[model samples]
Target: MSEPDVSKVLRLFKEEVKVINVGLEYFYKELRKQGVNAAHVIWQPKPELEKDLEDILKKIL
Candidate 1:
């Protein structure tokens, strides 16, 4: 049998994400679609994901 994908367990949980400010409005919508919250701390954004986050924030907010 093929090895199981252990990576899934290390991934983010759906409710783990926290939404705030003007973004909370649609936060739940996206979270439900992805099957995981993806969000973590509501403070500073991760440097690696900064670029993508900025793009999304600019478009949405």
Candidate 2:
């Protein structure tokens, strides 16, 4: 295997990066106010029993 292309990754980051704010509405609003492309998702804590499964699903989905 070989090292990845850092220049290509940097170019893509500069051109097409986006921010996803999963919990805080204020942070998302602030980012948008700064002219950034951002999105917000309302997130809530699951019940204690469901927390473990929800964490796994969060990673997979």
Candidate 3:
């Protein structure tokens, strides 16, 4: 496939691009402080027997 236009991608960055922070709440907060549209997904280790979280991660990945 052909490469995407870098200029177009850079133009999008000039606008508000919503960010989904999978971890590190502080990083999300810092983005907001800079007037960025950001959201956080609180992540933590679940019990070893838990499979639901792993399934969700698979879908996202």
On lDDT, the candidate that comes out on top is: 2
Worst 10 residues of 3 by lDDT: 45-54
Off by over 4 Å in 2: 1-9, 50-61
lDDT of 3 by residue, 1-61 (tens): 9987799789887976888998888999999899888779999986584588888878899
Per-residue error for 32 in candidate 2, Å, reads: 1.1
**TM-scores of the models, in the order given:** 0.21, 0.54, 0.52
Model 1 per-residue lDDT at 12: 43
Tell me the deviation in Å of residue 27 in model 3: 0.4
Q: Rank the candidates by lDDT, best first.
A: 2, 3, 1
- Model 3 spans with C-alpha error above 4 angstroms: 1-15, 50-61
Worst 10 residues of 2 by lDDT: 46-55
